[model samples]
Structures are given as structure tokens and as C-alpha cells.
Target: MAALFSKMLTKTDIESCLCIRASPLGQLPFEEGQRVNMHVHDESGQEWIFSCSIEEDENVGRFVSVGWLEFARFKEILT
Candidate 1:
């Protein structure tokens, strides 16, 4: 499948406190408050499913919430 977007993980990304920010310019197909299943694949071709909700903020626009930190941890991402 084609990628919707990509980000080089930062220290904050692996932290459990934050969610992955989707680009405002990317214009995701889903609507706000919509729950979507995200398929994440690692470099080794390992795949993980994240059940995320689309959240909108006045300042940040859209972001993927829930299961991101777990995905990072499962991938053993250090950064």
C-alpha cells in the first residue's frame, strides 16, 4: 500500500505523552472524531495495527491519537 505520509521520529515521538502529528497539508481522507485503523510497518517488514481516532485541535489541526506510543515501543524506536 502507498504511504499517506512519513515522519522521522523525534524524542517526543517515542515518549508516551504525545501523539503522532499528521500534516495539515496532507489532507487525510477521514473526518474529525473518526476512528480509523492505521497499519504501521517497520523497516524489517513487521506490521502493527493501531486503532486511532482522528482528533482536531484549533491550533494543530489533525493528529492521530492512541496506540502511537505502543507502536514506537513495540518497534523499539530509540528516537
Candidate 2:
């Protein structure tokens, strides 16, 4: 026999957008032209992953661009 359950999802509280500053120099170990998988959690607690570029930089720990998943999160914060 199969069973089903009904659950109520609560509305999530909006979180303040976080402003992150990239390191002056690339301190993280990632090569230019490389990409990293970004994990993002929505207000509803749902999570997603996306790839982002590591743009050319001399710094070791530099953030080139925000991933697609993060872009969505940012958009939500704006609305």
C-alpha cells in the first residue's frame, strides 16, 4: 500500500542581502578560465547549484563573477 502525507509550507522570512568583497588578491586556489560549482539556498530552504567563471586574475583568492544560482538569489533579495 502507498501512503501520502499532507504538509504545510511556511512563508520564509526575507533575509538581508549580503555584500561580499572580493579579496584584493587571488588567495584561493583556482585558475583563470576555471569554474566552480556554487550552491545557493533560497528563502524557502530550497537549494541549487550552478557553475561560475573564475576570470583571469593574479590574486590567489579572487571571485570573478557570481554563479547563476547566486544571481537568482540576488534577484529575489531585490524584489
Candidate 3:
């Protein structure tokens, strides 16, 4: 069974994406390059759902990065 792995933020890319680290127990059930849907909650308790691809695996020492699309207006302002 595939499990939902929660991660801690290790770094942030210039594009506003997150590079997260894994758990001390072990590697996640996900495979490298596997794209999966994820959910995140903001401070106000609203849940946001999105899809992202896995960028790392067990060999990478518990670090994984998530790349996602930025909102059109946000991308324009950042550029």
C-alpha cells in the first residue's frame, strides 16, 4: 500500500517551490520520478490540493523536491 509521507522544508527554489527532507525512520514508498497528488493546509486551515513529481529516492539521502505550476499573475510578478 502506498502511504502519504510528510516532509519538512529543507530549502526553497527561486521559483517558490520546496525542497523537503524525509523522515528518520526510512525512505518513502514512492519511486523516483513518480508523480503524485498532494495536499497542504494553510494557516487558516484551508486545504489545498495539487500534483507534483518525485525528484529523489533512497539514494539521495532523504531529500526530495516538488515542482509545481505557479499562478499566472504570481509568475509574472516574479519574473
Candidate 4:
């Protein structure tokens, strides 16, 4: 049970952290409406703890990024 919880929470952390790093204009190469999933762990010793891609917004530069919780729901809707 703990392991399952950890996995779920890990994704949340990654998403939260990424949102902080993404541009407000959404111009950082991520598609406006695409969902990205990646493992975020600090063992690699890099500034970036994970990798991501935005795969779908019509106006990539205009779509504002939301918090992790909201983005998760948005991604679900996109799918």
C-alpha cells in the first residue's frame, strides 16, 4: 500500500515541480494540450529532475500552465 501511494505521489511532485519551471507564456517547447509523464528522482545529480513534453495546444505560446492538481484534471480531459 505504501509503495502504491509513493508512486502516485511521486508523479504529483514531478508535475508540481515542472509547473514551477515551465514558462508562463507556455513557450518552452511543450505542446499546449499535451500531457507528459516522467519519473522524477534526484539521483542523477542534474538541475532538471525529470523530462517532459507538451503534445497538443493550438496556441502553444498563449496557454497558461496551471498547478499540478488542476493540470492533472486538464490532461485527463485532453485524453
Candidate 5:
């Protein structure tokens, strides 16, 4: 499967939300306001499903509205 996008995890990403850069918006298969299932997997083959909403911000552009904190906790990511 092709990757929709990828990002290097930052402090904000682990503590807050995942931001999708505006430059790749045009290449995304989904549109703004669409809800999509985000499948995330770790190196050990552990997987998690996150129901996310695609949203646009006036200042930040587009981002995946997901329960990032929950995922971060599961992955043992330190804040």
C-alpha cells in the first residue's frame, strides 16, 4: 500500500495532534471534512485503528483530528 503521507514525530505530535502539511494536500485521496480510518503499525507488527476527521485550519492548513494522546500513551511516547 502506498503511504498517504509521513512525518517525523515531534514533541507536539506525541502530546497533541498530527499535522498534515499543506503541500501534500492535493495528493491526498480524501477531501477536507472527510472522515477516514487511519491504520498505524509499529515495528513489532502491533497495529491500531484511529477514526480521524480531516480538517482545515485557517492558520495551520490541514490536519488529522484524532485522539493523539491515547495513541501516544499506548505507544509509550513520553511527553
Candidate 6:
């Protein structure tokens, strides 16, 4: 997984920590409050593993899963 930021979309998000919004990544293996490794990859082979959970939105193709780092890292990377 390549942590493609360009492909991220936020519906109703929790912007406190990292948010890996699950719309892009399909079939995540996690239960509600269950900690799992979210593997993300970018186009250039850069990857990120987010300590994530199956939030209130746990649909296979329409929910957002967040990484505790996307919030912190996204800001640093952009500016």
C-alpha cells in the first residue's frame, strides 16, 4: 500500500489523529475498537502502517478508517 494522499476522501471524519479513510483501501481486517495494521502505499513505493480500527462506519466500501499519524504527518508533509 502506497499511502496515496491524493485519493483520500473524507465523509464524516475524526480529524484528531491519523485518518486513513477506508474508501480507498478495501476489505480491512479489523473489528470495532480492534487494533490492526493498516497497510498503505503510495505511487512511489512509500508506505505507512496505521494503528487503526473499524469505526462507526464499518462497511466494506463506504467507511473511513483513520491512522493516528495521517493527521500529524499530513500537515508536516504539506507545509
- Output the number of the TM-score-best candidate: 5
Give Cα distance to truth, residue 24, candidate 1, Å: 4.2
Q: Which window of ten consecutive residues has the lowest lDDT sum in model 3?
A: 69-78
Off by over 4 Å in 1: 1-3, 8-12, 17-25
For residues 15-58, write the lDDT of model 2, one tens digit per residue.
Answer: 32221224543364566578677676656777777665555435
How many collisions per candidate?
0, 8, 0, 3, 0, 12
Candidate 2 residue-pair clash tally = 8
**Which sections of candidate 5 miss by over 4 Å?**
1-12
Q: What TM-score does candidate 6 reach?
A: 0.45
Model 1: lDDT to the true structure: 0.67
**TM-score for each predicted model, relative to the true structure:** 0.59, 0.42, 0.47, 0.24, 0.65, 0.45
In the range 1-79, model 3's lDDT, one tens digit per residue, is 3445545434344356655655543666676678677676645776666565546455665555555435323335334
**Per-residue C-alpha lDDT of model 4 across residues 46-74, encoded as one tens digit per residue:** 32223444433444333323334444443
7-75 per-residue lDDT for model 6 (tens digits): 443433334544455656666666566777766665577777766665664443344456544734554
* Candidate 4 vs candidate 5, lDDT winner: 5
Worst 10 residues of 1 by lDDT: 16-25
The candidate with the higher lDDT, 1 or 4, is 1
lDDT of each: 0.67, 0.46, 0.53, 0.39, 0.71, 0.55
lDDT at 37 for candidate 2?
A: 70
Report the Cα RMSD per candidate: 3.2, 12.7, 6.5, 12.1, 2.8, 5.4
Rank ordering of all candidates by lDDT, starting from the highest: 5, 1, 6, 3, 2, 4
Residue 40 lDDT in candidate 2: 63
lDDT of 1 at 54: 71
Off-target runs (Cα >4 Å) in candidate 4 are: 1-18, 24-27, 43-79
